[model samples]
Target: MDEKVVRYKKNSNDIHVLPPSPYTEVPKPNVRREKLSVENEETIQTKKKLEKTKKNFLFDPRRKTFLGRSSLNWARLAAFYTVFYFCLGMFFVILLYVFALILDREVPTYYNKDSTMAVRTTATVVGMGFRPQPMVDDSLIRVSNDLYEQKRIASSLRLYRDVYLIQKTDAKAEPCTELDPASELVPGTACSFSWFDIVSTQDHPCSDNNMYGFKHEEPCVLVKLNKVYGWTPTKGPLPIHIQGLRNIHNNKSIAKPDVYITCDGTNPSDRDAQTEMVYYSLEKPSGSSKYGVIPNYYFPYRNARDHVQPFVLVQFKNLPLHRLISITCRAWSPGIEHETRGMRGMVAFQLYRSQVAEKLIKDDN
Candidate 1:
């Protein structure tokens, strides 16, 4: 055993390494290889899943722009109705203008009438600047049984003539003397026919000594009628008489006499006495000379009060009147005709205004 052991010292490069044995396969890198393969496969599968998720979440620009246009179209439709409502507001403005033109035209009517019988009347509405004609209404004609009497007399008498008288011419006076008896003409001696000579004819008979008697017998009958045309030969005031004479008289003086009339049966001749004939003088309000007589007193009973109704008012006019005070009134009677009398029942009388009658008086003095 000792003799078989031989020791060999190998050089650094001289030792040849034997190749791995083919029968004893190389030790496979089993765990690491398996791990590397599994890791690579898992990475590829995760990348595939990320690509699918990105495709599902995709948004298109064209589809978003289309939706924005649809919203603008809806906004435009809403604005159109607002403009249409503003345009429809003009219809009310035209209607108000038409109503203002109808209120600017009108007329006034007045009816005035006077009658003796009962008749219904109405006023005809006429146009401006013309008087309205009254119409008869037959529904209100009835007379009340109130009868009265009224008398009227002349207030004044006027005359135009020269005065004369019958007298003899004095022989001792101048031959051509003037015999003026309140006459404008002078009678001379050369005057052949005297007033007596011409009036003594048979045609003008002065047989009656009565001053009021008239005989138309002479051509100078007009002269005789003047002297005899006075009132009854009463001792009171003589009636006014005027004569026309061209010749002059010897002693008689011609004078003008004042005339008068009375409603109460009395004669007044003095210049101061004319006041008695005046029933009412505008100067005095009440007294003996003042007659407070209303002109409408002659109306029937029911009609009498009609003039006195409260609706009537009298209005005075004119600054200064001669002898009468003028007053205006508004009448309100319906004037309906009565069934029985076939006449109007009452007349309407309305007084507009009144004042003191003295405003119209003028003193003769």
Candidate 2:
């Protein structure tokens, strides 16, 4: 007998049709039912989102869109950024020109202490600097009597001295004393180094031959006047008390210099132990008893091309060993401003020495 059967069509749902007779064979359906959907709402949503993103990233040739933006929109953005950066660049260039206009090539905009404002703790008044500084940002003078250290120090002193000795001044320059009125001191007049020759002075403890007195534990410290442009010192007589400390008898008739450089111990004990303190200068050699002087003639420094700053060489002797001695060296003049807090118009540092073996400080090298 004939039987009714169900058949599946791809698009339509279900149909009842005649099955194959004994004359023809039909394969059994492996799938029980059509796969309505194995994927859930989440999977469909994810696929939809990915397709949307791909469409946004793809170039739309029909719409003339690039990087997901319409050509017109892209043009607007490019124009905006170009104008923005161009204006920014122009503003920067204008600021640079303004700064250049305010600045001078000859002189600094802010000089002296003002140049260091918000950058340093040093006082506004000029302060001296020390050389042969082994450590940075430190003012300690730890000059041990060790032979090796002494030799290194002595070489350093000679190099420092020779810097001025070997210096060649401008041929156009003349003597500073010969400067006429309205002298800007350009390429300043030369001062003969021979007249100021502590470095080459014979037999002096401050001389390089004696290793600047560091050979015998009698360390010498060089003090230089802090340079202040256009400063003119008012010459005056050295105080009697300062002269007494210097162990020098001044002939009152001879005029004294304005800047009297004096170094003494800070405390009573240190002062008493300071036993032997002497002074020498490259400019005026007053027998090591008088205070070091920077003559008024060296004033009104104009930042010349060949200007040599005056320095004072101080030799210390009879100091106690293996102890720290606080020393304050100051430039005293009638009008020079000094601060109680800052070492203004002055410089301070501690001196310490260690015991050393007896060795000849002078070597052929």
Candidate 3:
């Protein structure tokens, strides 16, 4: 009933009318998101307030929420595992320290398997007249452990040398290993000693046995040296040869030298002492005995000089001089402490004076 005039427009709503076009002008809805940064301290405080409110609503313990219980269990498990791992690591560290201590004491003192012996020997040689050279195998040229050792021969007839050995026990199975004094081996492994004199006369002269004593007097000889020395073995036996006192060849008269005898050959005073060469006469037992008395020169110092030195020759004679046996010789040296070095030379004799004379005449000598 009221006066209404219709206006021409593209789109017209009875109450609100506008032109119909692709572009429409209306207030855009605001979409806001919060950001926090160090540049503005107020942003951090606002963010904290929002986080607190959301956390309280979502994770209230008194509300008995299943999500809250799951999160708490996860936290408790993580803490327990962290503490367990820490304790386990501490236990291992303590164990390793104890093991190292045990090995340090036992190895160098009790067993003769110390590698430092080699080091000390090397040092001593350098200090003296000799020079040290590293040993090396052709195949192991690039490896660190491969080395060669060489020294010049001494001018003196008596020489001293050091022997070295490397020992190892691997309880932890480390590929790189050293001696473990704390550990005991079932059979024990040892390194071979490679030091000796080029002029050594005994086949297999070992200082350890020379000082101690020969197990079998099969070819017995002893040398009581001033200082201890080591020997090396070649092939089945040592290349060294030992010559007996009876076999000593000299152009001098039949008169014997002033001989001294001592079980303690290493003692300088005793080293110069010599045994009395006593001749014993044997009598025939009226042609009744099958075995005749054979002349024997008894040298009683075979065992005493094995370890301790200055072994003296005890020369005593037995009858029946036809059968020739074995001959052995020993040496004594000068040093502060007396110790046996080793047997130096030996000879197996089966020659007759008559045979020697025939050969000499035949050769026109």
- State the C-alpha lDDT per candidate: 0.24, 0.66, 0.27
> Residue 14 deviation, candidate 2, in Å?
45
Candidate 2 segments exceeding 4 Å error: 1-102, 108-124, 162-166, 169-173, 177-196, 235-257, 356-365
lDDT of 3 by residue, 207-284 (tens): 233321121211112222222122111112111111133344443332211111122223343223322222111222
Report the C-alpha lDDT of model 1 over 10-120, residue by residue, as the tens digit.
Answer: 764454445444465444578988999999999999999887555543532545333334556658877887777666665555565665555432211211232322134
Range of the 10 consecutive residues with the lowest summed lDDT in candidate 3: 141-150
How many clashes does each candidate structure show, in the order listed?
30, 1, 39
Give the Cα-based TM-score of candidate 2 against the true structure. Answer: 0.63
Error of 3 at 359 (Å): 60
Task: State model 2's lDDT.
Answer: 0.66
lDDT of 2 by residue, 270-346 (tens): 78777677777744564465567766566656665555677777778877877888888888665465664866778
In order of appearance, the predictions have TM-scores of: 0.12, 0.63, 0.18
In Å, residue 339's CA in model 1 sits off its true spot by: 89
